[model samples]
Target: MSGPPTASEDAPIRVLLADDHDLVRTGFRAILGVEPGVEVVGEARDGDEAVQQAQRLEPDVVLMDVQMPGVDGLEATRRILGPSSPTSEVRVVILTTFDREDYLFEALQAGASGFLLKNASADDLVEAVRIAARGDALLSPEVTRRVIARFSTPGPAVQPRRPPELTDREFEVLVLLARGATNAEIAGELYLGETTVKTHVSRVLMKLGLRDRTQAVIYAYENGVVAPNGPSRDGSET
Candidate 1:
């Protein structure tokens, strides 16, 4: 199947707002409404509506709230972005007032491309939409630190096994991705051009059947491809 369609550099990013609260949706619409490259295409007051609107509108980015009355944002996200959906390419960014770890992990597992607290500034919200629209995973520094810490805690020692499907270079790319290294950073570390790094990243995701880099990070840790507190690019424990 074809992947999600990429927006042209000059095309405005189409966005959908999914929040139960009218005020919250209004606030988001206001924030994104004035942004030059972002367009608020639709709104959903509940999870069911979110799914319906997502299918109908096919927005490039969905700003989803986790605590809707029914279905909830996580399940709505799954329905919208899961492999079965024709609109799976549509990116969902979980927006919540809660800073709970469970919500963060659940959102990622549901194929959300980003997660942001409602308290985040207007600039952060705008950037989150832009980042997800560009097909990059978005996690705030605080959230990233939490994710790394979760995996970095010492666990029972087990021998690391590289998946046979990946080339050695692909494995290296996965490690850097799990370390929260951006494509540019990976390029610098590996002495490759940015375009080459992007190709490796795409291959890594394709081979692993991952939706995006966020899943790659979880897969690397869960499968023991890279251990917690593993060697960093600088050869020090991360």
Candidate 2:
């Protein structure tokens, strides 16, 4: 599948709002409407409509609600970002009033690029769109903590095997990424320039066929590349 959409430096970020509530949609539109570099391209009141509009509009970002009549947001997210999607470049940011763990985990598994609580401030909403547009995952601290906690729990023991395609440096980058280190932080730890770290990160993602860092984290844990709550392969604490 294609990577997330990239908005040019001079182009406004195109956005599609998908929520059952008109007021919620309107509120989002108002918050982003005034932003100079963001545009509300369309709105969808249900999951089916969301899927349709996302394919039709090909917006850079989709602000999706978790619960709505008909197909619901989680399914819509899968359809929008699924391998068969026509607009594979679109990034989905799940917006929900509920903070249930099931919804959070399911959203990520559905290929959502970000997840935001409905209680977030207007500024947070605007920043989320920009972040997703720039091909970054924007998980709130609480959500991020939940993800770490979930993966840190011990599962059945299995040997961790590294993908042969990744070099030693790329493997290190993936380990630090799974440990929640940012590119700058990874650079500091590895004594590499930020640009070089970014290159390693991109290479790690591309080699592993991951869509974003969030997926990289999930992949690391699931594949036992970095043991949860334990030292990495290099015998250093993650």
Candidate 3:
């Protein structure tokens, strides 16, 4: 499988703005226009238009509003990132004002790489776009806490799904990931090189059939790979 784009310093990140309100879209365009390595390539007034433009333009990142008139951003994100789509590599960043858990869960399940509040600053927005463009999940600490809580709840007696087969080291990497550790942090904690940690991360994502680290974090909790105040896959507390 191919990895995310490793863009050079000179290559600007292509972005597609998708929101129902024209003024909101315009404001976002204006903010992004001034960033050095970001360019708004297209605009979509609704979810349907977002999907169409994403397919046609294949931008590196899509700023999608969760609540649109029809089709909604959640479904549009799934369609754009689903395996059947031609531009499935496109990364989606869900934009919303509400901090509801349902939207957060749905967005992550739909394969969104980032979740940003509407009231975020211009710098946060630009950084989130660049992060998504580089194929990383941009979950704020607040959202991370929600993720932990949502997936850490007690469930039915029966197991949800069998755990994927992963190497011992990869399993350790996943534990740190579920604890919200970044690549460099994971490397330091594991006493491994950052590049090696990144490889293990990629392998873990591939093996789990997940879209990105955010989904992997969810998977770690839901499948009992890691638990709140519980031992990790290697039978050790994280």
Listing every candidate in turn, what is its Cα RMSD in Å to the true structure after a full C-alpha superposition? 2.6, 1.5, 1.9
Backbone clash pairs in model 1 (N, Cα, C under 3 Å; residues 3+ apart or in different chains), count: 0
Order of all candidates by lDDT, from best down to worst?
2, 3, 1
* Cα RMSD of predicted structure 2: 1.5
* Global fold similarity of model 3 (TM-score): 0.92
Clashes of each: 0, 0, 0
- Model 1 TM-score (2 dp): 0.89
Model 2 clash pairs are none
In candidate 2, what are the lDDT values of residues 1-238, reduced to their tens digit? 3455679899999999999999999999999999999999999999999999998888999999989999999999989888777876689999976557888888888788988779999999998999999998875556656777887777777577787889999999998888888888899999999999988988887888888888888888778788766877667676
lDDT of all predictions, in order shown?
Answer: 0.84, 0.86, 0.85
- lDDT string, candidate 1, 1-238, tens digits: 3444656689899999999999988999999999998999999999899999999998999999998897999889989987878778998999876557788888888888878878999999998898888888885556666777777777876556687888878888888888788888999999999999999998888888887788888887777777667664334454
Query: Candidate 1: misplaced stretches above 4 Å?
Result: 152-159, 231-238
Model 1, residue 163: distance off in Å is 2.0
List, residue by residue over 1-238, the lDDT tens digit for candidate 3: 6765544578889999999999999999999999898999999988999999999988999999988998899989989988888878898999987556788789888888878889999999998898898888886677778888776677664243335588778888888888999898999999999999999999998887787898888887777777777666567885
C-alpha displacement of 58 in model 3, angstroms?
0.8
